[model samples]
Target: MDNVKKRAAELLKSEAVKVVIGYTMGTNGKPRAAFIQNAEDVDSLIFNAQCVQNLAVYLSKAEIKQLGKPAIVAPLNVLRAIIQLASEMQIQENELIVLGVSPDGELIDFQNFSAIEKYLEDFNMEVDAKEKETLEKISSMSLEERWKFWNEELAECFKCYACRAACPMCYCHKCAVEQNKPQWIPVAAHRLGNLEWHIMRAMHLAGRCVNCDACHEACPKGINLNFLTKLMLNDAQEEFGYTGVTLKEGNLLSTFKTNDQENFIQ
Candidate 1:
């Protein structure tokens, strides 16, 4: 953590970065996001297993971008988000600096975000053994059973929009749910409205979600919503040969190819 603090201070002192977005020990004995803008404040920065918030979300914020050449302390999720965001042209390569943190809570020495992305090649986005078992259990169900399962699960949502707020990929200035002119999605917080919201969100995140699990984590209802995005991601990989955040490839949905399969239309 000292190495991170030292580099962060050096960057701030040298004006290499106007701000250092990192984690700090919160009053509730947990980690919280900290925007360190001065050299002396680098001591407030911390990184550990408890630091799970995806700081990369701020990369798209107009205020953060206006600060100029910001430096971010990126965990694996943040790193993945950065690559996906960069690929989507949501952010420029030279616009920010990265302080990469490993899963074991060690700071990595990366020359640039590109090098950080290269480092990410070693990681996999798939869920763990327990989660895989759960996914398989869901897969075993018939279509009607699956529908019944999801219908029961999604019935808990209260229209808080916590999932959308937590997702780093959901960076649209105006979300589809907010469209009042056409009244896209129902305003009520019932099961149907909740189901529509989750389905639309999953489709929007088809080729962009990094499997970060932030949405699931942030949900007050404790919905296993991560599975929906993971389903879309796996489908993108199987159907389009696109692995969402490959960094070298374009988005699975946006990139058109003549050889893409159309058998599903039949």
Candidate 2:
């Protein structure tokens, strides 16, 4: 932990990056985002499974941009988040630096995000036991059944945007549903309105979701929002052969290749 902190501090001191966005222990010792301005604060930064908040979410924020050329002490999920964000043009690729860390607290000193991505296929694991069970139950449902299930499940939503707020990939400066000029989404929190809002949000993240489950975790109503996203992940992989986020230089949605298939769209 100290070595990672020292390296981040050195980067800041040398002006290699203007700010280092990483994690520090939160109020209850849970991992939380920490932005280090000077070397003195580096000791506060730490990483572990408990450091669950995606650090990539903050790289595009106004305050972080003011610091200039942001660098992040990235977890695997955070690195994936950056790749997805970069593909969307939310942040410039050259302005960021990723300090890769392993699950066991070792520093992958020489590995950039791209290097880590190439090997991600071998490391992909299923979700936790309970989440896996939930995912399985959801996946087993028929399409119409699943549609009806989500409609009833999301009926409780009040358009709170809690799911959007928690998602690392949902960084739109002004979300469409919130706009009054177009008034695309109804303000009423009925099943019809709620379902459309949720669908729209999930579709926006189709090729980009890193599956951190932050959106579901952020849901106050306890809706398992991953029901929609996980389905999209399967479709993106199977139909388009566009596997989602990796630490790779170009994410599935980042660019268009002439050889790519568009049959799914038609």
Predicted structure with the largest TM-score when compared to the true one: 1
Residue range 1-266, candidate 1, lDDT tens digits? 88888989999999999999999999878888898899999988888888877888889888878877888898899999998998888887778888887776677877765786788878877555687678789999999999999999988888899888888899999999999998879989987788889899999998899988889888998999999898887777678776447566788777789988876675
Q: For residues 68-103, could you state the per-residue lDDT of candidate 2 as single tens digits?
A: 787788767876676677656676657787787778
| TM-score for each of the candidates | 0.92, 0.82
Model 2, stretches more than 4 Å misplaced? 110-113, 119-122, 125-136, 142-148, 246-266
Supply the TM-score for candidate 2. Answer: 0.82
The models' CA-based lDDT, in order, is: 0.85, 0.74
Taking every candidate in turn, the Cα RMSD to the unseen true structure, in Å, is 1.8, 3.6
Error of 1 at 14 (Å): 1.4
Evaluate model 1: give its lDDT.
0.85
Runs of candidate 1 with Cα error greater than 4 angstroms are none
Query: Best-fitting candidate, measured by lDDT?
Result: 1
